[model samples]
Target: MQIGVDPGSRYTGISLFTGSDAVSPKPVAEPAVVRAGVFSIEVQHRGNQIREKLTARAALRRGRRSRNLRYRQPRFDNRTRSVGWLAPSLRHRVETTMSWISRLQRWAPVAALHVERVAFDTQLLQDPEIAGRGYQQGTLHGYELREYLLEKWQRKCAYCGVSGVPLNLDHIRPRSRGGSDRASNLTLACISCNQTKGNQPVEVFLAGRPEMLARILAQVRKPLRDAAAVSSTRWALWKSLTVTGLPVHVASGGRTKYNRHRTNTPKSHTLDALHVGVVDEVTGWPVRVLVATATGRGTYTRTRTDRYGFPRLRLPRTKLHHGFQTGDLVRAVVRTGANQGTHVGRVAVRSTGRFNIRTATGLVQGIGHRYVRLLQRGDGWTYSRQPEQQPA
Candidate 1:
């Protein structure tokens, strides 16, 4: 068995397969995909929350120290970050991907691992037309970034297309939302257009003008944050996979694309993962993908804190209540209650023995514990299935 991992910042696609024809003399059937799906995580949002808490904590400390409350030596250089230290959220991405790989290995007779070295090649995607030309800096022709934007955008507002007006460089994705300062994310916008679209994502701002939206985005690079996240975590993920002692075969994004195009495979996260290595033919993939999202084992803090860090609400120290812990997948068979019938989902436990089951349709609350039966113990992930993507 072999595994192909198409690692992304937000969603890492993984496929477990068995290569059939590699050792066969005659033409054998295609590789069989035992399982495939994305491992999802909200890296940016989680990182932001961590940074916010650190900043708030520092502010509170500075406030008290400078208030003449106590005389303490200034120790600004007391600590230093070790080499290769990634932020908590980005680090989580690497750790979680590794954790799932270990789980997958247990389920299959995995022999080798084919992992993409990098998710995107900046040079290849600057322009769709510039393919095979070996263009590095795109179609700038030695002009500056701002000048390039002005000319590329035809000196007009990309959103409104109002020419002959004072135009400002706008971010298709706002900086606050983790957008980068790269040229691809930059565009020309008039003063009115800029303000009207202030801090709002380009997609939401141009919802009414989809044609205009598509035109602007076509010139833009893939979302900068996602690219950055994948780039930052790629090396770390690759390094972790090496310790597994499998013959880890690294592949480039271009090779994955080439294999996918040659095989006429439909574009999907799981499919991309399946096509990540050197291959002649591709087939026999499962129709359904098992989407495993990393929800994390519940937080360590039992007390909810406010902005000032004061405990807003305190809960029982124990996470498990009434023999059911929060996040346990369960089936509730209620014979007589407002939430009658059967419901299957992750449960939110309550001390009163009345839990809430979040199912696919909706939340069924006030479910008695006696009616609930544990289906699977939640190990910090939620699972679902979706049909494989079809070709356009």
Candidate 2:
């Protein structure tokens, strides 16, 4: 079996596929059968944790420098970043993906690996009509233009201010009326607005609302800040995946989308992984999709520490409290309390016998451990959701 992986920051899609001619108890009839699944890495404080810690550390340093200026030496040699240095959050994503790949290899005989190494052509995305020497004159590059448009238009129809509607890229000045297909001349409009505004100019269309026209023009000119820090790390992830000693096949984001659309499958990470490459058809089989979620084992630091890195409360010496760990999935039936109902989710074991159950709605704290029944042991992985079936 070969594996197809679509790795993202939070969720990694995985699919195991067997060739058409592969022998089975029941005769095989499909070109390929995809066993799709998603891996959701539940990192405690995932991305925000790193940001918070860095901010806190900086604040502390600033406070210290202000208080003791004479003793504190000013350091000025930390500006440059070394080669191939990835941010903590991005590195965590890569590590988690690799870890899952290693874990899955034990269960299946993975012959090859296919990954979507998406590299967005910022030039093409910003200005789709640019050809030949026109590329040299373009000023705006990267996803900033798209981000700017979305922000300026507030991700809604600029004409009507209607949100949650299917939007389309529309020309403020109609093409028939000599409008250049530049970013400045573009705006997002719902289907209704687009049809209503047919070939009419922005001024004529918004004749009744002069204020709206002024606002739209002003928003179009405003440029968005560059996102160099948020530049993609997909290529780096692709490089890391190549070390698995298997034949690695790489596909682009566009190709993946085209395949997915051709197959008429629902949009999802796992579904995308299943249709990563040139998949024409898979007949006579109902595809099973597994959803894997990461549930961390209890942390080494027992106590709940304060912002100043000081222990706030003493935790239990033993990790297991009444045969339940912090990350274990459990069903708690509260007999009597403010929240007197059955709550099911990951449990946060406490030393005082009052465990915290994280339900779908929110965390229900102060629940007695006696009421919690272990649904699944904390194996650092949880498959809470059932496998999704795709029609043949």
For each of the candidates, give the backbone clash count: 0, 0
Q: Which segments of candidate 2 are over 4 A away from where they belong? A: 19-45, 67-71, 123-167, 182-187, 201-231, 282-324, 330-344, 359-367, 370-383, 386-392
Off by over 4 Å in 1: 21-78, 122-229, 305-312
lDDT of 2 at 244: 80
- lDDT string for model 1 (1-392, tens) is 78888876556777877665444454575543333322321111134445566686789689878988778998888688998788777788788778878987897788888888764445434553454343334332223345346545767888888997788989889999999877778888999999999999999998998998787777664344345665778888888899999999887665676667767776566677888767777656876777776666776657887887788998888888878899999998888767779999999998989899999888888888989999999887777777776655
Cα deviation at 31, candidate 1, in Å, is 15
What would the per-residue lDDT of candidate 2 be over residues 1-392, giving only the tens digit for each residue? 77777765556776666634433445555444334333322222144455566687789679878977577656897799988888876666667677777877887888878887752345555556664445433432323344446645767999999997778888999999999877789899999999999999999999999999998888777754322322355667678778888888887555566666566666556666666665664432224445566544655655777887678987767888778887888999988879799999888886778998887688898998888898887766655444444544
Report the C-alpha displacement of residue 380, candidate 2, in angstroms. 5.7
TM-score of each: 0.67, 0.69
* Worst-scoring 10-residue span by lDDT in model 1: 36-45
The C-alpha RMSD of each candidate to the native structure, in angstroms, is 9.9, 7.1
